[model samples]
Target: MGLVLAAGAGRRLRPYTDTLPKALVPIDATTTVLDLTLANYAEVGITDVAIVVGYAADAIAGRVNDFQDRYGVTLELVPNDKALTWNNAYSLWCARDLLSQGVMLANGDTVHPASVQRTLLDARGEDRQIILALDTEKSLAEEEMKVIWTSENGVRTITKLMDPAEATGEYIGVTLIEPDAAAALTEALKLTWQRDPNLYYEDGYQLLADQGLRIDVAPIGKVDWVEIDNHDDLARAREIVCPS
Candidate 1:
């Protein structure tokens, strides 16, 4: 299953997000972030996708039938009512039951080619119950969700609170959650949200790692991808996807 977290109201990307959710914002002339995401899943031969929607849920819900027909994939909409008040840890927890079947979870606001999913799916296995895509090439920034790993690739930390200098790579917001770790991961997410409703889902991974869950990192080398958080990022995304 391909799971997408698309609940947040992209306040930074406002006026554009004032009408449509961030995922529905266009990158290419005709393709939106969620469009590319669903296409990636289709390219990988994953036909089932579940999208967690809020903050303009109607926009996404209205497009479901068209997206399914266009991509040849089925979509299940998971509503996150607290999306305006709570962070993504809660948005993710809303799909615990669906995630128990194994999933390639991606952020709906991120735009990446099919190769990103292929790389993660290729590296996942029994031992690596949680696999995250890391961009080793990207320079660290305070806002980027950073990651540190052991020599064996076990994720040591994943959060935005870490100093940029201490990070090994930037998590690009895509992950593979194997069924074996789904229950524990769900519990960890719950704990993270309960502690602070403002925490990102990365905190859930940190909690899981602290409890001895081995989250592996898969470096998406030299890939053209962008997370659309603000206008600057949206500009970069257009260049990445519709470059002359």
Candidate 2:
């Protein structure tokens, strides 16, 4: 199954995000961030998709049929009532029921190619429970969700607060959550949101790592992607997806 967390209110990308969720924001004349996402899932043979929606949920709700028809995938809408008040930790946790199926999880705000999803799917194995798509080749910055990982321990730390110099790479908002890791991840996410509603889902990953979970990393070599948090990011996404 493929799961997408689309609940956050992107306050930074106003006017465009004013009436639409970040996922629904148009990246091109005929494609949206969500559209590209579903298309990617379909490309990877994941026909059952669950999207957690909030903050203009109706907009996404209205597009379910269209998305399903266009991508040849089944759409399941998961509602997050706390979307307005809480962060993505809670939003992701809302889809815990679907995680047991071994989910390919992606952040709805991220715009990337199907190859990123294909990379994680290809790297899946019995030993790998939670695999994050890491961009080891990208230039790190303070804004990027940085990860400090070792070949032995996998991911030691993942947070945006860390210094760019210490990070191995940036987590590019795509992950493979195996069935074995679902229970622990659900618990970790619950604890993360309960401790602080403002925490990101990456905090949950940190909690899992702290608890000795073997979180693996798959390097998405030289991929063009962007998480649309603001106008600049949206512009970059446009350039990546619809370069002219």
Worst 10 residues of 2 by lDDT: 8-17
Q: Score candidate 1 by TM-score against the native.
A: 0.97
Question: Taking the tens digit of each residue's C-alpha lDDT, what string does model 2 give over 1-244?
Answer: 9999998779898888889998998888989899999999999899999999999999999989999999999999999999999999999999999889999999999999999999998898868999999999988888999999998898999999999999999999999999999999999999999999999999999999999998999999988899999999999999999889
The clash tally of candidate 1 reads 0
Residue lDDT tens for model 1, 129-219: 8889999998888989999988674998988889999988999999999999889989999999999999988999999888887889889
Query: All candidates' lDDT scores?
Result: 0.92, 0.93
Write down the TM-score for model 2: 0.98
Off by over 4 Å in 2: none
Every candidate's CA RMSD: 1.1, 0.7
Candidate 1: the clashing residue pairs are none
